[model samples]
Target: MSETVVSVRDVNIYQGSNLVLQDVNFNINRGEFVYLVGKTGTGKSSLLKTLYGELPLREGTANVAGFDLKGMNWKKVPFLRRNLGVVFQDFQLLTDRNVHQNLRFVLKATGWTDEKLIEEKINDVLDKVGLKSKGFKMPFEMSGGEQQRVDIARALLNSPKLILADEPTGNLDPETSDEIMQLLFQICKDYGTAIVMATHDFIVINRYPSRMLKTERNRVLDSAVPA
Candidate 1:
């Protein structure tokens, strides 16, 4: 049996009065890499938002990395996000800062204050993401693949147990997407970080098949079981 890290039961989400997700339920386990797929606007992003408390779970319950989303307050949102490493379709790296500086920015904002230790940690995570020599390069100076690697490195600075990525490879070409997926999968295997990535690329799914969840007909479907 897998260790459950995220559990969503009968969850419903609303955005300014429109019901986006209805009765969504799933259990993602530790060290797992799961894919979230559906047509655009099927509520994949909303479900991820609800799990991370970006949107409120008004009709049910979701517990992610030990925090209950249904009852959590704004003060706890940062705490919830701290346990998660979130990646986006766009590389949200700062153009002004070099790769190492960008990662150090996250560490400092998250309350890491040690000078020597923070530098060491930044180098460590950059090395882990296979971007050791590029730490001094700015985001625009690197290739798209390298920039995405920096995004992953920034997400790893806090040692999160779970990563929620929404359309993380939407902008990349196939080869670059494959490299990024490999890096994410390696993170799961090496650090036991459970990942829930929402994507629309079918070829990637066929290549690295895992447990999947899809949003369809306003319901979340568990792809491992017969529908």
Candidate 2:
């Protein structure tokens, strides 16, 4: 059976009072790798925000990682986030912390109380991202690719069902981007985690094609749909 990680139906996304995307509908299944592509100001960010519960979904029936987006509130947002991971273009690691402490901080904030379990989880993610030995290094001491790996490792700490990656390879060189892309695809396959990556890199898309969801003309276009 195919499991849905994100489902948006009859949605109208907005930024403040401005309608950003209209009639958006899509379903992303578990272990699927989907690319979200759009030009600047084409409502891609709005759609991502809605999926992650950062922006209120006032005009749609959508579910992300089994949480009803329409019913999301400030109190429920944290719980919803626990089931999802978000990766950014910029490796948003704290400058003062090493990789281990950075990962530990996220686990603690998300309510992991057992020290032994936390240590194990951190180790697990670092190993997955090919950074097992670099956990003691500070973010500034690492290369762009390594920092991005730590960011990915941090995202995996909660074992989320869906990962929302915003331009995850935007900051790296072509070679480094390839490495990150491979790691992302590996994670999706190995863990059965769904990924929705928003990117403007057409070169990356051509190199590693998959299902694509494009935001254009105030609407979302799915490549799965026939013209």
Highest lDDT among the candidates is held by which one? 2
Segments in model 1 whose C-alpha atoms lie over 4 Å from true places: none
Local error of candidate 2 at 71, Å? Answer: 0.6
What's the C-alpha lDDT at position 148 in model 1? 81
Model 2 agreement with the true structure over 27-66: per-residue lDDT tens digits: 9999999999999999999999998899999997999999
Supply every candidate's count of residue pairs whose N, Cα or C atoms clash at under 3 angstroms. Answer: 0, 0
Q: Please give, for residues 92-171, the per-residue lDDT of candidate 1 as tens digits.
A: 98889888888888888888898999999998988998988888888989988888888888888888889988887888
The local lDDT score (0 to 100) that residue 226 gets in candidate 1 is 88
TM value for model 1: 0.96
RMSD of 1: 1.1
